[model samples]
Target: MELTAVHEHVWVIRGAVNMGLVRTQGDGLVAVDTGLDKQAGKTLEKAAKEIGLPLRAIVNTHAHADHFGGNAYLLSRTPVTVYAPEGEAAVIRRPMFEPEYLWQGASPLPQLQNKFLLAQASPVHVEYTPGVPFEVDGTTFLPVALPGHAAAQCGILVHDVCFAADAYFDPPVVDKHGVPYMVDYLATCRSADSLRSVQAAWFVPGHGEPARRPDAVIDYLKQRHEQAFQTVLAACRHPRSLDELLADVCRARNLAPANPGAYVLLRTPIAAYVTAAVGQGRMEIIMDGGKLQFLTIEK
Candidate 1:
């Protein structure tokens, strides 16, 4: 991975997942996030060393394995202090919380325990509050709450640059993942709306190229949420169980989850979408033949 300067002191290593770096006082680098695993951590450390900066600290945007999985490895090499949101701290300190949650709070299946969802345990030295500015070696980074994608995901801002970690995605990403995973569709929409007022010279997303304008990405995200919500409502014309409804949604999107991980990944978000629809009175639940099902509420 190669590190390119985004601003005077901000840099990003773009890959399947982007790792952000902020230059601190005295040639120190604070990683906005470390990528997937020990290998990813090694790559980030090497890239920082190439630029002549010692890795000093890590600010995990969320607890997702892919985003913070490299934390432990990086911490092992350089005893840097780790700062993360209060809500996500437990999951970071105990990697299994992620896969367990995906398994509906039961013991996660072996299929769900992979490094993609369960990262190495990393200590959280500081549990930060959202919208607070924290200082690291005389450089300040503003952590803005961007929930929904993950309940406690955040985007860090510094020097006219916004390191938006999975807050929003480009249109192509939306097109690729038809029913994009999210914890709460409404909260994600709210975060996208919040992005409207942020003026930055550069906006860097965890998944795509840096953009001067965040409008297009935010708009595309909103459109995808609406499309997914409508698809769920339409699929509920007849009373259908969650399983049947999810299958209908998958068929409509031309998606066939081929693995247990992919199945749960899609299932959780579909449930959120259904709950949102039902909460707004656009859909309703009923008991059918001893099975619980959802149906569109006649307007």
Candidate 2:
């Protein structure tokens, strides 16, 4: 992991995750988000120590395993406290909640139990309120409510730099996965609009490079999400089951899921789009032939 100084007091690890480090009045560093697992946490700790920055605390943008998975490892070795948005904090405290919900609240399959989806439990020492300036020692972080990816995610703003944790992916990382991984279609779109107005000098996303002006990147994300939603909506005209709609959208996009764990999760995006359509009166849920199906409403 490489730490590049973005601002005088703000530095970011530019790799898979744009993990942030904000120097405080005491010169200690506050980690924006931990990485994938223990090894990532170890590397991060080593990186900070190499630069003479002692770890003080962590602010997890969301409860997704990849973002906060290293929290447990860091807490095990360091005295750093963790802060997360309330609903997300609840999930991080009980890491299994993600996989359980993904698997319809039943026992999650072994494939869904990997570090990618399941991380060691992490304690949330603080529940930050969005739109409020979160204080850590003498440092103040403006935590913006960036829901959609997770129920309660926040984008931390410090030193004129916005640590937009997956609020919108950068160009190369946009739609990296076949299906858009979102829980709520409308919320995700609104968040795209919200991300563009954060007024930060630099926007560092969880994936891809930081952008000074991210209009193009954010627009691309919106376009892709619109296409995904429209694809699902179009397929619903024929009254298809959720799985069938997923297949139709994937086939139209010429994408293949990497594994069963991934395929199962794709249902979320599909359901999100369908739910939006239902809310907008463009689609209706029905039961036909003992199967749940979605049908486009005739306007």
Candidate 3:
């Protein structure tokens, strides 16, 4: 397991779903986020042993399987308190399973299916709410509320570190058109923007390396998002089918057609973008029978 010190007290285990360990006061340990599968448990255990800290609590940023899949393994072996967003706790504790998070435009993996099934066999007990402050093992944690990405995702604020989950990635992921995923662009921007008030010196992302100066990344993502939103609005001068809009947008940006599932995956965020734009009077949606088409409102 490759453990990198992201901050003074926070260490990141770079694997499938970067796990974090933060040392609290009085030799108490806080497991910020767990990895993707059972193998992640082994890696976390190894890292914990290296630090010689007892794992007292595990705080999940959200309910995504990638961030919480190892819950069963970690909770089973250690007498640890597991915490998650209130909206996600019920789903996590239920022995049944849902898709967890939807992925569009990606190849299906059978291994993921088996892992979800295995995780459903047992549920963890700890849960929490946004903006709520609590203490465990001598350290205080403030759950910063961030919506749009996930309903109840909370970025953790501890000893000069904010574990900013998917709200912001270190090296932003470009879309098929070399554009960033700005579906919830505005909300995500606001979330990161609000983080400016936080006292943290560094921020850790779920999928990428930790960030010291996230201002540039956040700015780029916001700019790309506004550009994408404006582009969609310009193309919607006349009513356009979703497929037509996707094609026009994809072509104007010169995106490739490699994955068949990309279409489905992009729809959720795209629809959200359209919804927000429509609400703001930048665009409007017309429903003909069951078919929905979008048009830009002329200024």
Candidate 4:
């Protein structure tokens, strides 16, 4: 992992998941987010030690495994307080909640318990209020609410650099994933709108290079979100069960959820689209032969 200085006090460890580091007054640092697993966390710890900065604390922007998976490892190495957003604190505290919720409150299958959905449980010392600035070891951080990618997800703002944790995907990542994962479509759009209004010198996404033009990035995300909504709507013109709709939408988008993990990941976002359409009165849910189905409303 390469640690590049993004601001006077902010440095980002660019890897599979971009982790942010903010130098404090002392020989300490506040890590914004950890990577996918314990090994990823160890990498960050090693890099920090090499730079003569010990991790004083960690601020997780969300509860997603990829964003906070390294929490357990980091804490194991050093005594550090972990801060997470209020709604996400519960999930971070009980990593199993992620897969449990993903499987709709039922016991998740082995495949669903992968690192993509479940991270090692980490204790949260503080449940931060979104949009509130808090101080840690003489450094200040504002947790900007940017929910939609995950429940109660927030972006960390420090030294004019906003570490946007999955608020939106980089254009290429969006293209690669085909269907971006989101729980609430409208909330995601609102979060994009919120990011557009952020006056930041630089913005760091969870999985992309830091952006100088956050507005442009948000614009692209908005367009993709709209397209996703339309795609799901078109797939529902003929009443179809959730499974059938998922298949048709995947086929139309040239997406293949080849594994159980990929299937569940894609299924959740598609379910979000159906919920958004129903909220807008553009679609309705019905029962067909003991199966739940969705049908597009005739305009």
Candidate of highest lDDT: 4
Put down candidate 4 lDDT per residue, 121-225, tens digits, no spaces. 999999999878898988788989999989799998888998989998888888888888889888998997898778899999998899886777778888987
C-alpha positional error of residue 283 in candidate 4 after TM-score superposition, expressed in Å:
0.5
Cα RMSD of all models vs. native, in order, equals: 1.1, 1.1, 3.8, 1.0
lDDT of 1 by residue, 1-299 (tens): 76778898988998878998888875798998899999989989888877888888998999999999899888888789999987989999999999999998999999998998989999999988888899988888888999999998888888899988888988787778787789998998998788778878898888888889889889888988898888888888988898898899888889898899999999988999988988898998899679989999878
Please give each candidate's TM-score.
0.97, 0.97, 0.84, 0.98
Error of 2 at 178 (Å): 2.9
What's the lDDT for all of these models? 0.88, 0.86, 0.71, 0.89
Off by over 4 Å in 3: 94-124, 175-183, 254-262
Candidate 2 vs 3: which has more TM-score = 2
* Candidate 1: 10-residue stretch with minimal lDDT: 171-180
Tens digit per residue, CA lDDT, model 3, 190-249: 886776676778887776667776787767666766676777888888898777877777
Q: Where does candidate 1 stray beyond 4 Å?
A: none
List runs of model 4 lying over 4 Å from the truth.
none
Q: Candidate 3, residue 282: CA error in Å?
A: 1.4
Error of 4 at 160 (Å): 1.1
How many Å off is the CA of 204 in candidate 4?
0.4
lDDT of 1: 0.88
